[model samples]
Target chain A: MEALLEVRELSLRFGGITALSQIGLAVAEGETLAVIGPNGSGKTSLFNCITSIYRPTSGAISFRGEPLTRHSPDEVTRLGIARTFQNLRLFHNMSVLDNLMVGRHLHFRKNLLAAVLRLRGEETRHRRRCEEIVEFLNLEPVRKTRAGDCPYGVQKRVELGRALATEPRLLLLDEPVSGLTQEEKEEFAYWIHEIRGRFGITILLVEHDLRVASRLAGRMVALDHGVKIAEGTPAAVQRHPDVIKAYLGE
Target chain B: MDLVESYAEDLRFARRPAARVLLGLLLAALAVFPWVAAEHLVFLATLIALYSIGVIGQNLLIGYTGQISFGQAGFLAIGAFAFGHLRIWGAPFALALLGAGALAAVAGVFVGFPSLRLKGPYLSIATLGFGVAVYQVFVNWEVLSGGRSGLAIASLQPMFGLSGTRWTYYVYVLLLTGFTLAAYNIVSSFIGRAFVAIRDSDIAAEVNGVSLTRYKLLAFAISSFYTGVHGALYAQILGHIEPQIFNVLESITLFVAVIIGGVASIEGSILGAVFVTLVPKVFANFREMVPVVYGVTILLVLIFEPLGLFGRWLKTRLYFQLWPFR
Candidate 1:
């Protein structure tokens, strides 16, 4: 498999505290990689750094063989990288469909003048793209429902829909099923697989749920105290003493 | 199927009677304001309308887009002085106004460029400093602004070379109508949606490919453009251009009106402007106790209804409209 993302000696620090230290990782194209860790194990820190929310103190991140540094989150997104937040961050005031439409903003071809004037081709194309996304996400029925008013499971689904709407080649999900119920978690696992199968996009998921990782991830890495202690197939990582110690109690 | 449904939804919004009636009343009011009011009051109304235009820009930035700007007065200054000076140099007042808007928009981009690196209160401070610095420049530049004393504005020319208070009355009303209509168009458009999205969750907006910098700067630019037009209108109406009119207090008053009226609301902008404008005049009899009355009213409003008077009025209107269901 071709490498879609490469992180080399990625180090991030906040004042005197080192959040991530010399951690290197690579994601292959069309692969689902999961990062599992205890709370405060730097899983979220790494995600934030990769997404440019937290600029790394020192490191090199390359996407599709090109360097990714000194770029804002918005700039990184335009390069085809999209992510979902740990907590659902859907626009609360916007309807589910409008939330999804925001993801397609990069794909909007018309300028402000065209949008303001309701130009012929621009309006039609803009409307069509919005409709296509709503259908693709199975969000037609709840399209007009405000995102904040949705159930936890549905909100997660809407976040997924939003990420997918960006048409990114790489999708990063941070605990996509964190607060979901048992049934909802199962449904989310199924959709994770479905997304990979349907889109052939690379996915990097940060999840604490072992069952979720086992169900969908092709490979897994375990981190503890800001260090990657073990990495391999899910079964191998589960068997690793350090990984088990970090999770089950030392 | 989704596209078809969306089109149906769009049609529903277009046909909504509440939106239509509200808009109709706004237009009717703006059209009739000058005809009923005295000459001095008409001038005050023009000032309010002009200030509302700037408030419309602030609403887009502070209210809808969730970008904090203290430099709105800076943009107003750019517009006012540019128009004032250009008109003094024998340029057509209309063209000067257009030029002022263009210049302010370019300056808005200059200021907004540094904003991508900042957020929240930091951005607000940066913008505030920018406004103050611009005001200082206008004041110190004696040749352009006549320094602290200010410069005189030429009277507005009417259709077919008419002049005087009556002619200016129609012009102010027409300009106010045009500004309000433009603001209305923006409030209901895709651009408006983008700003609201950015306001609510900028990270989510970006992950979905809403470029934060592009939209932020666009908000600033478009907002400055409106403010510039307002400044031009102001200069013409007052027949005077001074840095004092675009000071920090004026900026805060405009912002206060929007907040007191309601953020992200066109009606709120107008209401706030009108209430702020006329309330002082109405309280002239109370003289010494005016501040007490004003302060008490503001505190009560802020405590009981945080969304401002217009927000409360909107809730009441909506309640009546959906009476049984609500």
Candidate 2:
């Protein structure tokens, strides 16, 4: 498969602490890639670097063929990349549907004059799109409910729905199912699998739950001490000595 | 029995018949108020309308966008003086009003730049400094504001057979209605969503494709524009423009109105305006006690109704809507 996202020699440092050192990876088109690591292994750091939330100490990140390091976070999203937070970051006071609508901000006309005139055809079109996502995510029941008032599992789904609303070419989910119950986990995994087939978009996820990660990801990269310890098929990466050592300790 | 069955229904200005009727009744009352009420009452109503426009603007920045500004009086001063100068140059009334707003909006953009890096109390102090600087300029610059002695304004010329306080009342009421509608449109649109998102979580907002710099600045410009127009109307009402009129105390009064009314609420803006405008009139005999009353009212509201007056209104309305269930 052709690569959709490429990272090379990405390094991030804070004073004496190196969060990620010379980390490199590639996500191919229409494939789900999982980055598995222990706490503080820099899984989130890699996601942040690609999303332009953190400027890498050194290295290059490209989406399709365009360089991404110099762009701001909003600019990166405009380049057809969208992401979810490990801890849900839904606009708490806004309704669930509004949260999804915010994802379509870049696509809106953004003309102040049009807004004042109440020219709402474009708003309706976008609302329709969000409604569809709300239906797909089984959020129809709480569509009008404030996001902060929703249950945690529901908020998580709202976060996913929001990312999907952006119509992104590449979706990055950071621990999408970390706090979910086992039943919710299975449901989320099913959605993750369906996202790949239904949306036909590349996904890069950082997951601490190895079982769910391996189940959703066809290929896996393992990280230890901010280093890429192993990369291969899920079963092979699971069995690799380095991966085992990283998880179970030396 | 009101149900929003479609997106369009949800976005309607008055979704239910009851609301539409209430709005019609309110407009009818306002239309007849100047004729039926005493002149002093009409004057007070006009003041409320003018301050309402400014309060709404302040709410947009502090409530919706979560940017604190104690320098709003500075923008108001700019608008007042801008109008005064424009009128001196023989500009038409409408042109002078708009020019004042535009000029103040420019100043708002400058003040907003500091907000890009500052937050909370630090941002408030920076804005406070801006307000003080504007006051000093108006005080020292004789050519502009006529210095401390002040610039006298001529009474507005009547049009369409209206005159004096009635004419001024109509103009302010009409503009107030227009500005309120525009603010409503802005708060409901994607731009408004971006503002609220920044307030809630700037990090998530940026990642969701909202440029923090752009939206933050837009909030300041729009907010200041409202205050600027208010300043022009205020100058007309007072019949004088002086540096002391737009001082730090004036800024604090506007800020107080936003807090006492409600944060992030449209109704709160109007309610807060009424409270700020009428409270002093109620205590006119005990003029020195006005600040004490304001302090007490704020404390009471903060303690009992943290969401402010609008939140209390919502609860009351909800209770009535759900009557017999409790």
Candidate 3:
């Protein structure tokens, strides 16, 4: 399988504290790869580097064989990479549906003249696309409610819906089920599973829950202290000696 | 209940039929107001219309874009001075107005640079310094602004067989209506959503593909253009442009209008403008007490209705819409 996203020798440091060092990973097209690690294992740091929020001290990230280092966060999204945060970052003041619409920002016709003229054809078409995402995520009940007011589970789904709205080729989910209830987790896992098959999307997720991670991802990469400890099938990675010591200690 | 069956219906200016009727009646009243009212009242109405444009501009930066600016007076001064210069150089009224707005927009972009590094009170102070600097320039730059004595603007040329105050009133009101529609269109479009997204979470917005630098500067330019146009009209109305007129107090007043009207609301900008304009007239007998009255009114509104006058109006409408339920 061709790599949809390729990371090589990526290193991130805050002064002397290294967040990620010599971290290398590749996500193949249409595959769901989970990065499982303990707290502060440089999972989010890797995502930030890929999105260009933080400049990696060393190494390179490329999507479809094109270099992604030094591109701005919005530029990354323009290149068909979308991500959700560990903590939900919904536009609290805006409506739930509007949150999804914002994900479609890059896709919208951005002519200021057209905007000032209040042209509706293109806007209506894009809005219909967002509506489809809303239906898929089962967010129709709170579609008009403020994103800040939605329950945690709903907000998570809204974030997912928002990422999906971007129509990204590579979706990065950071702790998508961290605070979700058991039922919500199951629902989220199902959605994550369906997303790959339904949209032919490639996913790279960071999960702390091994059960959820092992269930949703066919392939797994384990990280510890900013280094990749193991990478293989979920069953093999979970049983690796390095991953066991990183999570359970000596 | 009114149902929006189509996406087009959902995006309509007045979603409900009742709102459309109310909007029609309000517009009709506005069209006839100058003819039916006294001369002084017409002048006040015109002032409100012009000031509303400035207030709307302030709201766009502070409310929608979540950027604070206390230098709107500086932009206004740029506009007023630019218009004065353009008119003196034989530019037509529309051309002069647009030139004034463009000049102010250029200044707005300059001010926006500091915002990339500063936020909240720090940004406000930087803008306040800008307002002071502009005032000082007008005071010292004799050739440009005629110095401390002030610059005299010529009266408006007759158009459509209408001249003097009535013509000015009609022109200002028409421009106000056009600008309000434009503002509405902007706030509902993708650009507006990008602005709101940045305000809510710039990180999320960037991840979702909104460039902060581009949108922030655009907000400043657009907002400044609105105020700059207002300042051009104001120069005509006052017939004299002075450094003292575009002071820190005026900047504060514009900021107050955004808050007292409601942040991120079009109707709130107009409401705030009306309140700010009418207070002095309402206290005409006690001219010295006008500022005191403004202070009291703002305090009361902030405490009782944090969302501002427009929020209160929304609540009232909702009450009636769901009558007997609560």
Ranking of all predicted structures according to TM-score, beginning with the best and ending with the worst: 2, 3, 1
Question: RMSD to native for every prediction?
Answer: 3.1, 1.3, 1.6
Q: Rate the local accuracy (lDDT) of all candidates.
A: 0.80, 0.92, 0.92
Interface Cα root-mean-square deviation for all models: 2.4, 0.8, 0.7
Question: Candidate 1 regions off by >4 Å?
Answer: A120-124, B1-14, B21-29, B32-41, B160-163, B187-190, B285-298, B324-326
DockQ of 2: 0.82
Model 2 chain B weakest 10-residue run by lDDT:
B146-155
Candidate 3, residues A71-148, lDDT tens digits: the string is 999999999999999988999999998999999899987899989989877789989999999889999899999999
Alpha carbon deviation, residue A178, candidate 2 (Å): 1.2
Would candidate 2 be rated incorrect, acceptable, medium or high by CAPRI criteria?
A: high
TM-score of each: 0.90, 0.98, 0.97
Query: lDDT tens string, model 2, A1-250?
Result: 6789999999999999999999889999999999998899999999999999899999999999999999999999999999999988999999999999999999997788988877787899899999889888999999899999999999999999999999999999999999899999999999988888999978998898889999999899988878999999999999999988877878
Model 2 steric clash pairs: none
**Model 1: per-residue Cα lDDT over A101-203, one tens digit each:** 6777777674666545544354445667767756766678888999999888788889898888778889999999899999888878878888899888789
Clash pairs detected, candidate 1: A103-B208
Q: TM-score per model for chain B alone?
A: 0.86, 0.97, 0.96
Best by TM-score: 2
